[model samples]
Target: MTASSPTKQQDTNHFDPSAPPPFKVADIRAAIPDHCWIKNPYRSLSYVLRDILVILSLTFIAVVFKTSLWLWPVYWVAQGTMFWAVFVLGHDCGHGSFSDNPNLNSIMGHILHSSILVPFHGWRISHRTHHQNHGHVENDESWVPLSEKTYTALDAPTKLLRFKVPLPLFAYPLYLWKRSPGKSGSHFNPYSDMFAPNERRYIVTSTLCWTLMVANLIYLSTVIGPTLLFKLYIVPYLIFVMWLDFVTYLHHHGHEQKLPWYRGKEWSYLRGGLTTVDRDYGIFNNINHDIGTHVIHHLFPQIPHYRLVEATNAAKPVLGKYYREPKKSGPIPLHLIDNLVRSIKQDHYVSDAGDIVYYQTDYRMVGKKVE
Candidate 1:
């Protein structure tokens, strides 16, 4: 899958809708030749090997590459991409989607996310909640929507937090507070706790896992020199985030699909999951556990990561028009900005009959009801 074409290319090429939905998710799954399961040992091994190499290179930089800033950019590219890959694997762990063993998933996910400074348990809780209640405004994890009235009612100080940082890098720090728990936010990040009490255990565990990981940083920085920490490790971590944010955010928020936000019989896991978007990452999809097969992932979180495409393809026919695994080769920003524009102004979620509706972005009637 070539990166999706840019909007301009989309406009010019005109997404020939008749082109069979560009490969049905169901069809893809049915066609997953048995060979797809050989379980390549290369991905996990290669990335870890790279992590080691990155550390060594960082140490060398501290010792010799100090004359100029030339190596910093290289470090940024190397460390960021590699560790981010590790984070994606961590994501697989949260669902027991990586390997069947829960212990292994916990160990790997904790190591990877902690290495990058994310609280693993905190993220796992939110993400799991996200899976269980996706698209439901009240219970969904971190992405629960905000109505305009609610948004407006937020006290001035609270509102300030939304616009507090203009730059993405700086804004990253604010996310630590976006969890569902507030007591943990005492460091004073209001948005820090995003989950309910039932979810706290996972958060605590992931947090501890990362705490142990920081020891690696301590030893590396103390022994290898601060220069290595900045150049070899941090640089790659940054690069990895660029891709991580690009992929995950766009999969859900950037897509055109909006949750119908149904209740009772109206709310089927299938429909809500389909609200998720699959993407064309080209080779990156392979590394991401074909998480690009997101619509299916949301519906069956326990499914192993490798079999996602199978479930996706199996379910496509039933999904029909609900099927939306769009591909764009152009810049990711264009799509991201367009969608964020749609989501940011959300003010409320209103229940109408059996469905939910969102009010935002120019008057709305039945838009992808925010949830």
Candidate 2:
């Protein structure tokens, strides 16, 4: 059944997020101003340039204050955050939201992602899969919850690594080398089932770029001393991975309300896209290019990052209860840490048979006896 018309005020207490939205995706799209859809290449490139400059400045500051033990920790956090910001710009390029020119997108995507040792095309293609099948239990590419049977079968060590705090936050590198459990392809492998035969060349190019970056890092480590290199890059890279995993997992898995995952006929593009939740990152919101404005980004990824807030506001009436308002954040988003920890402890898996189902807690994981 469709939801009420866009003009009607939704009684949120009675609203069913799983219900098919009353308004069509087209209606929401129409509400967004035409200017919101414009992909300004110059604006996109300016962000890329801005992030690079910040990254360099942070590096310079760290080098100058190398002897300060206190500054090292601060440098790691800031540099890693800048790295994530750079990755977001590359993500825009992957979505074709950075520019209308395909060649420019490809060139810049490679430069940005390769610098961070990411397989650009491979990640872009897989992320496309995620956007296409976001809430589908089996088809979604990243952070899809395990089915009950699959969850039950997992070894204790695997479960611990997957759901435990700090450990799960470091999972992105492993996820790239070998995708999430039950999935088979390596993002670096050109011939993996994740990509079509024609896309092999793009994957190969990205993989090679990633390899070159790794070699460059290795060379730098040897020349500059491993300790210095670790301080300058490796530590920050790990922190960036944490930011990536933390943000991505929260977008789909953690909320005060249980969000539904779909299977079979219940899954549709609009419904799947709607399942994504936005987040407020406080001060990092703009610094990270508003990547936390995930709901609107998922719905209309073609919209540039700079306009997500405007587009989200325009479409809110059409979205109604289908849209979840994100929790507000202060100067520091310390509150999200609680949400992340609680969700990891609670959201373990979905049932195997349902067309739509919410996550169920494995009582044992939460220090309770299984019923």
Q: lDDT per prediction?
A: 0.55, 0.89
Give the per-residue lDDT digits (tens) of candidate 1, residues 237-304: 66665566555555655355333443444444544565567766565565444666777667666665
Give the worst 10-residue stretch by lDDT in candidate 2.
Answer: 1-10
Q: Which portions of model 1 show Cα errors greater than 4 Å?
A: 1-70, 155-173, 178-204, 224-228, 238-243, 254-259, 262-266, 330-354, 362-371
- Model 1, residue 143: distance off in Å is 2.0
Q: Give the runs in model 2 whose Cα sits over 4 Å from its true position.
A: 1-12, 369-371
| Lowest lDDT 10-residue stretch of candidate 1 | 181-190
lDDT tens digits, residue span 60-125, model 2:
999998999999999999999999999999999999999999999999999999998889999999
Task: For candidate 2, report its TM-score.
Answer: 0.95
